[model samples]
Target: MESNPAGQGPALSGNVMFYKKPEPLSPEAHGSLGVKRIDQPLGFLRSAHAVPVTVSEFGMAAASFPVIFVGNDKTPVAVMGIREGQNLFVGADGNSDQDFYLPAFVRRYPFVFASDNQSDRLLLCVDREGPMVTDQPEVPFFENGQPTKFTNDAIEFCKEFERQRRATMEFVKLVDSYGLFEQKSVNFTPRDQNGQEGPQQKIADYWAVSEEKLNQLPADKFQELRDNGAIGAIYAHILSLLNWQRVIQRALRTPPPGQPLS
Candidate 1:
């Protein structure tokens, strides 16, 4: 059998030469390539004869198109754009089914997109296994989202997800120990009957006192707290403080301190 070139595929018949774009183009341009639109929630675009494209290249064009869903069953997947920067984020959906992002096995694979505008496409293929779609009712979405589903029975997707969550919590606590969430405040409260305020009350009475005391705690102690569950709580507290800080800062910057807020 005759072999196709490394990057080039089989040639076309007649005087016409098959030319694949070096990158994926906008969905609107799909018509030019004879690609048909599949009416799915994810908004996938399909073409029978088109070649597969690389993720990076495909992403550039996919990002340009407003359609959130695009892909073919021959390549069961969805390509969507993430607003983080300019690059498009590609995802996979199964057989017109929902819950694409919940697959844990999918995370093991590095996403790929079409890299060229020509019909020839590039894709980053990973050997990692994926989850098999089962008849089980789709996992319910709730307060604590369901763990990623893995199609491959060989890998435990839930375990990996938990590990990542724990690592993230640890990092958050480390950041909170630096007093990054501390705030200044003024308030009036009564002291003890003996006219002597308790250390707890004093700390609350003077924001500077609390700040100084927190600062005195050894860095090692803070690290230890992070080793415990203190980090997650601290992270949550710091985020809350950050939001309050922004609100107060905006109020102070505006015309009147007490002016009816905008």
Candidate 2:
């Protein structure tokens, strides 16, 4: 249960996190767009190593993926792939298991609730690189220079996601204030000359909730955590570590590690 404080976790890539080519959805730019509601595969997601997830997702995400924290912000993320630029959940055919609980972060792709520092409003942005974004025909983003029903719905979904994101941030701050996080690293090794396990090699390090620190919380503070429903999430995170073995096993069947990624 002992841990070493690694100061901060690595930064997550903005590219892999969903806002790949974010552009404010505007009539001027998307006036002629007809984004159809069709069944399309997210083969592109194969390149994403991790995706930002909400606190609400901890329980469900832990069921399939190892939910971890990253960056100085301590953003909750679900590890989709063990190696860099490889998402094991996404098959070469570009489809994910339909039965698995898809994180809201992936579902909200191609659309983002962007903050405009100049104003207190959230701007709805769309990924210009989205495969579905086109000028031809099934769903129009605007009608008579006004947002269409589909576009409006997307806006509402983004707003809801933003609200969830805020609450998630609060949860992160709560955990941080409790001094329960520590830098953790996982190691792996190949067999040696006599078929014995070789030296363990560190592969990844990230911020995670420390079970020891968690157990050391003041009595009243611990009660407050339970009252606020954070106690369950803390345990869920600890339990999710079991999934890392599954993730590593998946990496063995895939392509060799390519480029190094943060």
Candidate 3:
């Protein structure tokens, strides 16, 4: 989930990788705001550096992106590109590459669940800048001064997402409790004309479960992690690191915003 540009901090409880202009959805302010369904609802995501993901998406998303953790609390994020302001998955035509798993974070765009820190209540929000948002939505958000089916569905989706987020938080806390997570980083190098490897370039840094520490856990702790389904997600993340090379290849084939493709 993207965060409010007002610097209210992370857009989502766990991750705030892509949110830029989040505004609370209100009946009075957005009464006429309707979202127009477009074939390319994700065009704006072309510029996203990275996106949040649910624990359920670990396996599928890991197959396509480098799943890593961010922030002091260790929020998990799918590495989309090796550089900032770039996303190799989005083509120059501004369309997400076909046949790829779409993370729930992006799929829930335009509408999101925001927490009112003071009230400790969850509120529905919309990205005023979202490309899918419009005054001419095929489905209106409000009808006769009341929320329509579209708004209702969005609320349901957001509510479910927030619930999943809480579950993910517990999982992260579980990993942290065991002290199994370690800071992770990667490097890249290109071969020179003569086949000599160039200077190693650092790609990105994040946290991940340490395989050694994970393996060294006590029986009870290990079982706890297993019962909670953290083991699979941890290994999935470890395996996804191999796909870093795959992302490198894609970056070479189609570069992101700042870095050009080879």
* Residue 213 miss distance in model 2 (angstroms): 2.2
**Model 3: worst 10 consecutive residues (lDDT sum):** 1-10
Off by over 4 Å in 3: 1-20, 38-40, 191-197, 256-262
Pairs clashing in candidate 2? none
Q: What is the C-alpha lDDT of each candidate?
A: 0.28, 0.75, 0.77
lDDT of 3 at 242: 83
Query: Which tens-of-lDDT digit does each residue in 14-112 have in candidate 3?
Result: 234455666777666777788886776677777776788878789999888889989997888888887677777876666787767678898788777
Q: What TM value does model 3 have?
A: 0.85
Enumerate residue pairs that collide in model 3: 2-19, 3-11, 3-19
* Candidate 3 RMSD computed on C-alpha atoms after optimal superposition onto the true structure: 4.6
| lDDT score, candidate 1, position 49 | 13
- Arrange candidates by lDDT, highest first: which order? 3, 2, 1
Query: Higher TM-score: candidate 1 or 2?
Result: 2
